[model samples]
Target: MPRSALISALLLASLSLSLNARAETDPWANYDKVLKTLPKDAAATLDRGVSCNHFSGEINGDNSAADKQTFREMKKLKCGTVDQDIASVKNKYKNNKAVVNAIQVYYEN
Candidate 1:
């Protein structure tokens, strides 16, 4: 390859690696950062809600002991409050699109 072509290829390869590294990063880091900006109660409520949903999704009729344990722990999270908290958070952050969207994305996942 010509020298300039080789340089361009190296730059493209470097950019690709950088993008892949970012793609593999822990999404929760960003989520946690966003939650940290909220009031303590709001952040806790949201974290619990997300955690509850995460565990709940793991449950099925053919559950292993660990799955049952997860279910029990999820129950303790009081998922019933999640909907109310979500509504409250949405209303409270209605003016902040980033906050609202982050919460929505966390729940959706």
Candidate 2:
């Protein structure tokens, strides 16, 4: 193979690897990824008394539409679409709910 062709093949392989690693290419994998983000313990409240089926603190409130949109873009890139359905849970009691979905995120000082 020519030197240029070798470089092109390498570049293409690198690109494919990077894309596959960053995005959840599989639908079931995406669902599992989101589910994994759910709080392990019992936490988060549903408005309609609906059980907490979907959950994730990974990109919950720690992200901004403009400031940071990696998570948002990832879903779109992977599934070629986005899921707009979102539920907000407020832990007013500061009880076990707080203990369950405790996020230990840190921001720049």
Candidate 3:
């Protein structure tokens, strides 16, 4: 191959590797990608529950009273439908072990 072609191929390979590494590191992103392969309604329901349950701790690493209150409020708002969503997804994909396992691993509360 020509020198330019070799460089272009190397760059493409590097980009592909980097994207794969990122997907491996970010479980949420990888789960979303997997969910996209499912039916729209199932994916939407599962994604909603996953998004509701997923959150990071405060940056300061303190579990203050304010943080606890905020978390409780958020749980009431966002987690109200989580159980239903999980059940719906489980029923919809029960025949597919891969889908069920994905839900168990990534989306369950």
Candidate 4:
């Protein structure tokens, strides 16, 4: 390959690797960022209520360490068990697209 092409290929490879690494480390980081922007009360409510939905995703298999930590945090918040809170969070996500989208992206990751 030409030198320029080689450089471009290397850059693309690096980006792919970084993205995959990020995906493996914390699938929910993007969503967490979205969650962070909510007002304290809303964030707390939503997190307490919906965090288990994210945890459910983990149980399904994504298995990111960051995701596990997020679940731990949610548990610490004294939210009801994962099943109890999941529906509530899903309702919030349906009502709040921005936050939900962020969380969806995390889940998608």
Clashes of each: 0, 0, 0, 0
- How would you encode candidate 4's per-residue C-alpha lDDT over 71-109 as one tens digit per residue? 676578664553344445656567777656544454323
TM-score for candidate 4: 0.36
From the highest lDDT down, the ranking of the candidates is: 1, 3, 4, 2
Q: Model 2 over residues 19-104: C-alpha lDDT tens digits?
A: 89767544334433433554542122221112122222334565566424645544433322112111122233245343233321
Cα deviation at 39, candidate 4, in Å, is 4.4
lDDT of 1 by residue, 1-109 (tens): 9999999999999999998888667566588788888777667877888888888778876878988898789778877678788778778878977667767778755
Each candidate's TM vs. the true structure? 0.68, 0.28, 0.52, 0.36
lDDT of each: 0.79, 0.37, 0.73, 0.61
Where is model 4 more than 4 Å wrong at Cα? 1-27, 45-76, 102-109
Candidate 3 residue spans exceeding 4 A from truth: 1-26, 55-78
Candidate 4 lDDT score at position 19: 90
Worst 10 residues of 4 by lDDT: 100-109
Whose TM-score is higher: candidate 2's or candidate 4's?
Answer: 4
lDDT of 4: 0.61
The superposed Cα distance between candidate 1 and the true structure at residue 76, in angstroms, equals 1.4
